[model samples]
Target: MAENIVQRLRDEIENGIVTNQFAPGDRLDEMQLAKHFGVSRTPIREALMQLGAIGLIEMRPRRGAVVVEPGPHRIYEMFEVMAELEGMAGSLAARRHTDTDRTGLLAAHARCEHSANADDADTYYYDNELFHHAIYTASHSSFLIEQCTALHRRLRPYRRLQLRVRNRMKTSFSEHGGIVEAILSGEAELARTLLRQHIAVQGDRFSDLVATLSQREAHSG
Candidate 1:
C-alpha cells in the first residue's frame, strides 16, 4: 500500500512536470504537495527523490525540491551519450541474444507496431520503452543494461515529446523495424549504426524538439 502510493505520487508528479504544469525552477514543497495529493510527507519526499534521481528535479539547500530545466545543448549531449550506449547495447545484443531474448524483442516490437498503427502517441511511447528495454535485456550485459536503463529513464519525457511531432511515431516504428532486423540477423555493426541514428537528435529532429519545448514553455509561462 505504501509502495503503491509512492508510485502513484511519482507518476502524478512526473506527469505534472512533463506537461509543464510544474514548470522548471518551480519549488516543490513537500507539505503543500502532501496536502494537494492528500498523502503524507514521506511519500511525497520519496517521489521527489525518485524524480531527482531521474534528472527531473533537484534538491536545493533551502528551497526544497525544484523542477530542473535542462537546456537544449545539455539535452542534446545527453541524447548523444544515450545513443552511443544504446548502440553498444544493440551491437552486443546482435552477438549474444538468446532464443528467449528474440521472442521478447519481437513481442515488444509487435506491441509498438500496434500502438503506432492506432496513432496514439502516449500508447506508442509506453510500448516504445518496452521495446528498448527488450533490446537492453537482450544485450546480456548487466552493466550495460543498468547504464542504459538509467539514462533512458532520465530522457523519458523528451523521448515521449519527440513522438508527438508530426509523423515521428511512424518514423520511429520504421526505424525500430530496421533495428529488429539487424539484431535478429546478428549484424552487430549494422545494428549499432541503426540504433545510433535512431536515437541521436540531429538536424530536423533537434529543431522539432526545441520548437516543441519552446511552445510548451510559452503556454506554461
Candidate 2:
C-alpha cells in the first residue's frame, strides 16, 4: 500500500513536471505535495528521490528539491549520445537477433502502428517505449542494453513531449517501419544509419522542440 502511494505520487509528479505545471527551478515542497496528494510525507520524499535519480529534479542542501532545467545544448548533446548508442544497438540487433527477438519486435511495431493510426500520441508514446526496448533486447548485448535503457529513461519526458508536435506520431511510426525492415533484412549498416537519423534531434525537429518548450514556458509564466 505504501509502495503504491509512492508510485502514484511519482507518476503524478512526473506528469506535472513534463507538462510544465511544475516549471524548471520550481521548489517541490514535501509537506505541500503531501497535502495536495493527500498522502504522507514519506511517499512524497521517495517520489522526489526517484525523480532526482532520473535527472528530473535536484535535491540540494538547505533548499530541498527543485525541478532541473535542462538547457537546449545539454538536451542536444544527450540526444547525440543517445543516437550513437541506439545506432549501435540497431546494428547489433540486425546481425544477432534471434527468432524470438524478431517476433517481439514485430509485435511491438504493430502496437505502435495501431496507436499511430488512431492518432493517439499518449498511447503511441507508451508503445514507442516497448518498440525501442524490443530493439535493445534484440541487440543481445547486456551492457549496451543497460546503457540504452538508462539514457532512454532520462530522456523520456522530452521524447514524450516531442510526440505532441503535429504529425509526429505518424512520422515516427513510418520511421519505425523502415527500421524494422532494415533489421529484419539483416542490413546492419542501413539499420544503424536509419536508427541514428530517427533518434537524432536536429534540423527542423530541433527547432520544433525548442519552439514547443518556449510556448510552454510562456504559458506557465
Global lDDT of each candidate = 0.89, 0.88
lDDT of 1 by residue, 1-221 (tens): 99889977987888788666898889999999999999899999999999999889999999989999676778788889999999999999999999999999999999999999999988898899999999999999999999999999988767877787788899999999999999999999999999999998432475576777678788877
* Model 2 bad stretches (over 4 Å): 1-12, 18-20, 201-206, 219-221
lDDT of 1 at 216: 76
For candidate 2, what is the total of clashing residue pairs?
0
lDDT for each residue of candidate 2 in 1-221, tens digit (9 for 90 to 100): 88878877887898788666898989999999999998889989999998898899998888899999577678778889999999999999999999999999999999999999999987898899999999999999999999999998887767877887787788999999999999999999999999999988432475577778779778877
Candidate achieving the largest TM-score: 2
Ten consecutive residues with minimal summed lDDT in candidate 2?
Answer: 201-210
State, as a TM-score between 0 and 1, how close model 1 is to the true structure. Answer: 0.85
What lDDT score goes with residue 58 in model 2? 99
